[model samples]
Target chain A: MVVGLAAGFAPAAVADAYLDMIEAETEKIAGPLPTVVDGEAGAESEEDAGFQEFLAYLKEESLGSYTFFEKLTPAQRSEVFERHKQGASLEQIREIIMERFLKR
Target chain B: MRNCVGMILGLACLMQPVWAEEVKVGEADSEFAVKLTEDTDYLHVVHQGKSVKVQRVQDPNYELRGYFAKTGRKCPPFCLQPMHADPAVTSVGEVEVLEFMENELRDGQGFLIDARTPSWFQKGTIPGSINMPFTVLSKGEDDPEMAAALEQFGAKRRGPVGAMTKTLEGWGLFEAEQKTAAWDFTEAKQLLLWCNGPACGQSPRAVRGLLEVGYPADKLFYYRGGMQIWQLFGLTTVIPDA
Candidate 1:
């Protein structure tokens, strides 16, 4: 089931680098969360209070222009929440965003 | 032995043969500048990803018809004028508008104003335009300088909050302000506001801003053909406050 979904939403080469960085940054904040459920779960929840703090700092610096939730599509946003529950790899989730939202 | 053989066979895989070719962004004929037929109300965007089928319920403004997995239209051609649920504005021809400009400017039909940032204004502007940056409108109400400027323009200050916020946010901020502010007719008969054209919406935003500030719609005309149009016509423009 996961592979089928991933196949549909594969990121392009150009966008994958940024996705990887976002994944790492989110993980560094979230700490040893579940890898299987990476995407939004690792990025959104307070599981990584430190990362949330970091995001707040970035948001403030950018004058609230950088919106994480708004940036992602409905499908990608929900996947992030699911990744948190599954403790998936941040990489996997980021891939979904690149493939599903930005690439298209 | 049979199960072991099957497992071994499953592990073996081969790369699938496929053609590698670079996909183009837009259709050839569609990209060219053409006078769109009035009867033609729809433009189909055929692309690899979500195919955007946009129907022109109104000129310039398109409505998304569907997003098909295969041959579905995700967005319309050239990212043109924004697709609005209510398309108040219409598209204009790049070529045919030359006479309109000469007539309007010659007859004093309108005043041209460049409402970009001071820095952008300094770079270049439409010939015979005064630079009144839109930043003044975006500033806080308590900003004494902006308040004073607004007063000079004869704008009413009803609320303590920034006066232009209602106008600004309504028109999608940056693009709307540029479009609406171009309509300020303090000194002229009609206002032509422009930043970039077609792909850019700053001028449209400014125009919408002016409309919010109680400017008459008839007195307002957006040069959808902005600086790009000016530059293309071999017409010279002044650089910034020059």
Candidate 2:
């Protein structure tokens, strides 16, 4: 489903760059995160204000990457956060997020 | 006569293990002095002028059926949940649930939620639990029930409790916040939620939906054992008047 959305704007190659940019920028805020345990990122960040900082980046970041976040409902976005909390990587988050919003 | 006395003492000693007294712990301040917690464990809840005990039922005749007995559910929809719904969320057993009831429910600082439908809830439920079906959180694409439930659970909207926001892609979400949404943690209440059991996706789904809507995992407690385990422990359940 997200692949279809990826096709709408940037080609698969461009979406890859966008995904990479989002990951690199995210790692800058909270170091390199595991793809599977990314849910821990959301899990640990509830009390930490730092998670909010990273979340704001997803909301305001101009890149096409994570822009699909805008299309997602709070519940859907939370699914992305939960995946990260559960150990999903940034790329995995993007894939998961795409699958969530684009498919629906 | 001395040997006869010794023989009687030996017989009494042999019977000790067979008829031991049930040890009770914790203090309940109501009418009766009920020991709710383990002797060293110490768990109790205060209500009105009485410190009521939160405990499992001691009845030996309790049995499980219906929702608690349904074990053949499908995943992707009815999957077995991980102990932690999220990184911060804690999976609670009957003891912690009772503790939460004493601490949060008593003071009105929290909720003991039964994540079952009204029909099931009407049949019977834990002493202090309220009904909230998972479908409320998982209904249609534009779920108004979920939005209201979130607000009722003490989650204030990023804008107004139910305001709409534009997704980056330009598809509008009715009340689903994406960019500017934030859950006000200060005003939020602690929630202890449960459904039929681990296999019952109702509570887990509701919790995940709440998490999806930015409910803090810590403020949310999953009673993974739910009614199935609750019944297994012979906990008290009352039929809702409704």
Which one is best on TM-score? 2
Please give, for residues B80-174, the per-residue lDDT of candidate 2 as tens digits: 77776666778889778877865677556787888876765655567667787766765432367876776787766555443223343145344
**Candidate 1 CAPRI classification by DockQ:** incorrect
lDDT of 1 by residue, A1-104 (tens): 99987776674442355334323322222222111112232123334345454345435654322355447544334434444334434455445445444433
Candidate 1 positional error at B130, Å: 1.8
Worst 10 residues of 2 chain A by lDDT: A29-38
Instruction: Compose the digit string of candidate 2's lDDT tens values, residues A14-44.
Output: 5356334423322232221111112222222
User: Which stretches of model 2 miss by more than 4 angstroms?
Assistant: A1-104, B1-36, B39-55, B60-79, B139-143, B158-183
Q: Give the proportion of true interface contacts each model preserves, from 0 to 1.
A: 0.00, 0.00
Error of 2 at A95 (Å): 58
For residues B1-242, could you state the per-residue lDDT of candidate 1 as single tens digits?
Answer: 22334545545422222336545433454431222233322222211111122221222232222111112111221135653211454334433233334345334454555655564555545444555554453344457765554454444454343558656657676434333332333342555566544544455655665555545455455666565544443233443323
Cα lDDT of model 1 overall?
0.42
Instruction: Estimate every model's Cα lDDT from 0 to 1.
Output: 0.42, 0.58
Q: Could you tally the backbone clashes for each prediction?
A: 37, 21
